[model samples]
Target: MSDLTRKTAAELSELMASKQASSVEVTQAHLDRIAAVDGSVKAFLHVDTEGALAQAAAVDAKRAAGEELGPLAGVPLALKDVLTQEGVPTTAGSKILEGWKPPYDSTVVKRLKAAGIVILGKTNMDEFAMGSSTENSAYGTTHNPWDLTRIPGGSGGGSSAAISAWEAPLAIGTDTGGSIRQPGAFTGTVGVKPTYGGTSRYGLIALASSLDTPGPCARTTLDAALLHEAIAGWDPMDSTSINQDVPPVVAAARNGDVSGLRIGVVKELGGDGYQPGVEARFHEAVELLTKLGAEVVEVSCPHFEYALPAYYLILPSEASSNLAKFDAMRYGLRVGDDGTNSAETVTGLSREAGFGDEVKRRIILGTHALSSGYYDAYYGQAQKVRTLIARDFIKAYEQVDVLVSPATPTTAFAIGDRINDPIAMYKNDLCTIPSNLAGNAAASFPCGLADEDGLPVGFHVMAPVMRDDLLYTVGAALESALAEKWGGVLMSKAPELVVNR
Candidate 1:
């Protein structure tokens, strides 16, 4: 493997700017890596080799002409299939939209292009971003780079897996109840869920409109921050987009000082359910923060206990409404349209054939929750719980600059471990749901490997709404401290994969 594939996005940018390496060389190296390992890792659903090389050539040409380029010019990225990229096939990991090439670019895609980032291709995801493990993907589950028998986190598992496998230095992922952060935890990479509206959601295939947040995924905190600034900011196209300046996240990640910072450990997020190795790593992270001069305190977010139940109800209700657009009328897969079938029957059959079991389950649950007679008892009450969860965050933020916890309750389990057990799969989002419910900024960075399984553990940090920079500030501090103690980045310890290069 070429060393270029191992460099951070920031490092790659520096080399490109200094003419030490051409954009085509960098892009080709990653494409080569994808060709070598992706068959085993199964990270990407599509690979845009031609488009990526063309973009790289354009950047090289512009550099030759002395035209100033964007800060991340010539960097390659792995885009989650949920985001629309003009003319690229976007399935969102479901057969429903299989081979469906989008006609236009999503706002996030446009931004990345304008910044001179070369998109390698679309990464895999859970069908419509629906499940805790990538097992729910209609295509197939993404296997962890650390252990091929285990799962990579879902629904954005493909994105995180790509980064961890070094097929792409940066990737895009959406967090709707832990999709981004959990996968990052399992893969020993960095994932951030910016404040819900901090990044535009116009082109993301909606799972739950209010909770879907597209953000950056990378191997290092600073790399994630660089990608975050590139893709974040107000967008008039998205009604929910925050109309304000993005926080100085890139600067904060570079600063990386946690002295005197007040950090709170959420009391409700961890306990008996958590794996012992995960808890051991979490406590070590807290102690490391304290040693770095952060004032670590245990803060109770009492209402957080209700986050899971509320998220399930609210997510399904919104998903029920959002997914209605895929009725086989306008575009995408259409089934049972023989001359004998009615339009309604075709629509029903198309959905039945296209959607996987988990998607069907959520739609049914959502439909019932939003039904006329049961709406008040289920969905309405869930909304009330959502408000309480937000209030819990608001109160906790008042006392501490940021809150910390284990990103997931446990390390990556076997691929088939919880597929048949929906409740067990749902539990994966327990720690990450509160942040999404509150629409605040949150991130997961590698802490250390669990002693029992030697799987990577993630330390999660969350900040107040629009104060996303705080996530990087704390994450960078902890990441640097942890790396020093471990003798290198946590990813250095990932077990090697045997692939024919």
Candidate 2:
């Protein structure tokens, strides 16, 4: 039998429905894995085993009474700390809100509950999901499963690490820039950032609101699709959420033949500046796509060169406005002497003490960008640049079914290697960040193992807006072929973990 902790959500659901395993049994197995391995990985900020088991028991009771179960019934999943979970302290991996338990659940969390998935608890992240490495997390850095001294990509590193380490089969993560896909690439798991508004954002703590997206991080492409379907679609609270028909991702994953697919290689990425091993594997992935009868074509997006600079400007500007809401009086941790200080002083003190260095730097930079004279020069220009990038994707998609690129420039780096050189750290997302700027659907899965470090390397597959089902179709095909080619799943090659706990 597959290890319960590592089985994909689809497989677990089948076991639950067939009465071969109780929801509680599945839930406990995941909790056990977290207890066993996540300590060394440092994936979770917290793990709510009690609440998870309670929810599992409820699902078991429903099954006992012959009630109809939800499609992903009883699956245990984690929320990236950036999302609010009722009764759990929703720290955005920053000290500012360390003990603040949200009174309500994020829309994604609510929907997952309605679908009967148990909440395992919040995972760690870069503070406010701002950085490329989880080293920025106030709690501590999350280590890559492939090598403990290396980083799993961020700001979804916690979720990626958790899934890759076998702590949980699935988790929800937010992506702004390359947060989701890059982590998936680094950790050798599957992570998707659906088209903007493809998944609702209500109750998620804000981070570059226009660019922020929440989606699934899972062990397999099909499982990521399953979790996505459970939480996708319009929510009355989120005005941006599209009210269109949610696609049949699960069906698409199962029907994964890419015979007629047209895979476009973005001419802008995956050449120089990328690691030799990463480029080699990415080329092999293109060959695999070609072997599957895909019409391999090279397409150019001229404005894509502008993606990084524009992304930095716009994301920070929006983040400044969004984070302004975290004043001392309203929510989260408060500082300053209670009786002697005025609220303004307390607010200043609270913010000063709460935010991490990166968070403070962005806030200051954003503040300057949005300040009176610079608004038109910085933020305004970035918006127009965003428009140009979007237009580029629309034009590219006209000739290709989906776009492909190297997921990250290279494999995981040593924990503190690039932390001091912000630009160096930022370059890691060069190939992966454009999708966020364009608000399109994209996913990352292992393509091949990099010979340099024997760590997994990912190939990015992107589809036009709302064509997320295509990502799954392509991902499933590549995953199956690559696994067969590599002689096993990438995670099977991860070093056997020794749990400190």
Candidate 3:
């Protein structure tokens, strides 16, 4: 029998329908895992245990009533702290908003609930999703399940870690640059960055509005697709939400395969920046794809070299504008409440006290970049660079089906290694930011274990805009081939975390 904790959400739904297990039994199993291992992993910021159990009871009642059920009916899911959940203290891992409960749910949350996916709780994230590692979280750092002291990637680290640690079977995460996919690679799980506007952003706390995208984080591509389908559709509230109809992702995943498709390996992304083991694994995955009849060849998107610099300029410029609404007098944590304070004082004090170093750094950089005289030189020039990068991808797509590269330039680095060096941390997302800026869909799946530290390495697959299904097709082909070649799944290599039941 499959381990209840590790069963995919699809399996849980099937089990619930067959009366083989109750939703309470399954949801509690995941909740129990969180209670057991989360002290060290620190994956969750807040878990709604009563709400979760209550929802589980409702799922049971539905089954008892013989009503029609959704595909994700009874599956438990974790939300990134950046996404708002109704009546839940949605602290985006920032001390400034610690106790602020949102009055409504993000559209993604609404859809997931409609699908009957139980809310396991909110996962930790970088304060305002500013950093590439969970170390930037105002609450606390999340430990990698593979190696407790090592880092799990962020700003989606909590959602990534939860799945890796078996706290939940599925979760929602966002990617502004590499937040979702890098964390997935670091934690040995599957993370997808859907095409820009593929999912609605109605209530997700804005973080670089142009690049932010919410998608699924899970242990397998099929699982990710199942979750992705649950929340993806046209949302009138979000002006950017694509109006084009998306076919059922679950059906696509069930039939996914890339037997004779073309795969272009990006020539520029991985070089001196990559760890030797990561490069080795990348090449190994390529060889397997070639063997599986993918027409693998090197393709160049030369402007990719300038993506990091451009991303830094554009993301903060947009973020500076997007995050302006959280003034203390209006919403979020407040300070200077001696009854003698003006609105401005309370807002200033609250932000000054609550934001972490990284958030403050970006805010400063953004304010400078968007200032009167420097706007054209910095922000405007960066948009020109963004145009060039997008053009580069558009030109290259004319000759290939999808592109490949290392999801990150390196495997997960040790904790505190890049903390003091802001540029070093930014460099980690060099390969990922390009996809976000270009508004294309991408995914990162485990290729193999790195030889040096024995950590997992992820191979990135990128496709043009609105072609998210292409990611799964190529991803499944590579995943199946790599697993067969490696003799097992990457999580099989993860060392067991000893915990008392």
Which is better, 1 or 2, measured by TM-score?
A: 1
Tell me which residue pairs clash in candidate 3.
none
Worst 10 residues of 3 by lDDT: 247-256
* lDDT digits (tens) for residues 1-501 of candidate 3: 456887877788889999999899999999999998898889999999999999988988998999898888899999999888899999888887889999998999999888889999999988999988899998889989988888899899999999989889999999999999999988888999999999998999998888999999998888889898888889999999999987455665676666677889888987887899999999988888888777887899889999999999998888878777778766777889889998888888888998889888888889999999999999999999999999989988888889999888888888899999999999989889999999999999888888899887888989889888888877777767767876877776778776756
Q: List the residue pairs that clash in candidate 1.
A: none
Q: What tens-digit string does per-residue lDDT give for candidate 1 at 1-501? A: 349998999999999999999999999999999998989999998999999999999999999999999889999999999999999999999888988988999999999999999999999889999987789888888999999999999899999999999999999999999999999999999999999999999889999998999999999999999999999999999999999999999999999899999999998989979999999999999999899999989999999888999999999999999999999998899999889999999999999999999999999999999999999999999999999989988898889999999999999999999999999999999999999999999999999999999999999999999999999999899889988898999988888777666
TM-score of each: 0.99, 0.98, 0.98
Tell me how candidate 2 scores on lDDT: 0.89
lDDT of 3 at 344: 84
* Over 4 Å off, model 3: none
Best by TM-score: 1
Q: Write the per-residue lDDT of candidate 2 for residues 113-192, one digit (tens) a residue.
A: 89999988889899999898899999999989889999999999999999888888888998888899999999988989
